[model samples]
Target chain A: MVKLTEEMKTAFSKVKIFPVATASKEGVPNVVPIGFCQLVDDETIWIADNFMVKSLANLEENPNVAIYVWGPETGGCFQIKGKATIISSGEKFDKMKAIVNAAKPGLPAKTLIEVMISDVFQCAPGPEAGKKLL
Target chain B: MVKLTEEMKTAFSKVKIFPVATASKEGVPNVVPIGFCQLVDDETIWIADNFMVKSLANLEENPNVAIYVWGPETGGCFQIKGKATIISSGEKFDKMKAIVNAAKPGLPAKTLIEVMISDVFQCAPGPEAGKKLL
Candidate 1:
């Protein structure tokens, strides 16, 4: 299985905020910074649904998503593309809630988004730019 | 006409890199960190395409784009949604080339993407979160 490289995981772990992209059924694109995006296993990602509005709606209409990973502490930049599953109840969802509420008391973290990463691309500007890593 | 607020413009200007979102005609979402995303006017943005591949292809297939603006110096966060027009040759394209080449000589600065801002939304978490401003 093509999973996140150690360097990519290290970069993903250090960032507190993330930019998640989604598109409506009609194809309108939306991107927003999310704070509760977490790594789950090798090819999975967990995003707590706390403040999502249009993003959630878009996801319901279209499961496709692309997440950008890069920032000050991150040594490199990458784009992770995946198919998302919205989970409102279940063991994983409950675990996500606990993690979220622990970070901020009273936070609902209403839902959990399970993203199955299918592709990873290099975003660094160079000859390897846009190269698929997985 | 709705456009970027002064505060929003200020936030957009200070960022060294930006997250730009686009989708394929098939509705698959893609997001990448772009260093050349620039504010052109009240409702326009100029992105010098020094190195864009999938992003450019996505734009060609679907003009819709979403850009996330936020960072250390930005007081707040916002998502700028727009329709992109690609220009490979033109006066504005020439101008973009000069600006891009000035920053990095010998760069191709391949194309110019002009984004016409159609909607602006709050990305901050709160009651006003996800509220459209434009």
Candidate 2:
């Protein structure tokens, strides 16, 4: 509902590792650490891959996914809902790899999965001050 | 797949809040946090609800969802995937509401959406020390 600011984006960028949640048709789910996920545009977020694991499989089965960018100890969080498009080879994949590699050096550029966000919002009341639209 | 320990569960419990992500057919996704999500069983995780917003709607349309429990600052994270079942009124709802209200006092029991987890895994490497089976 609120705009995602530059500060929030910078904070997100600093967070380096984010937890990605993926699920299948039968209500089975897997949560794992993703090396990189970046905001491609106002409505899209991309996640890179080394092991084409659960999130990728779940995306192939169903495009819907939820990404949580906060911890229990940390006071704030960002939650996004969107459809995941699996891009193993393409310009989009290349672009994502570049961004990820730039942020996190030395990591191999494996497959990339981009989550085109449909909605973004804050979980807690006041990270409001941290948002600055980029 | 590493185990979820008593410490992880306790840490997750202390985190007080968690992120929930959801999506629909068009590849649009929304992420938000509910007051509580507890491990109902080893393979099942339940999320409570108040707004009944995107996640509830997405679940109704499609049961697939991914929940991320991590922050940029906090070094560890948990990612889980599973099918979401909207339980408006039932024993499950009542049970979830009790668990949530007990942890976070004063919130009304609007509705409870249980995400019956199919898989559970950590997002990082060395919090490897944090897995314990309840």
On lDDT, the leading prediction is: 1
TM for candidate 2 is 0.60
Error of 1 at B2 (Å): 2.7
Off by over 4 Å in 2: A1-11, A21-31, A40-46, A58-106, A114-118, A125-134, B1-16, B21-30, B40-44, B64-84, B90-95, B115-117, B120-134
- Please list, in the order the candidates appear, how each scores on TM-score for chain B only: 0.95, 0.71
Best by TM-score: 1
Error of 2 at B25 (Å): 6.7
DockQ for candidate 1: 0.82
Chain A TM-score, each candidate: 0.95, 0.72
lDDT of 1 by residue, B36-80 (tens): 888888999998887798989999989999998998899888888
Q: Looking at model 1, give its docking quality level.
A: high
**TM-score for all models, in order of appearance:** 0.96, 0.60
Q: Fnat for model 2?
A: 0.28
Q: Tell me the tens digit of each residue's lDDT in model 2 across B12-98.
A: 655545656665544445556555677765556777675545556667777766665565444566666567777878888888778
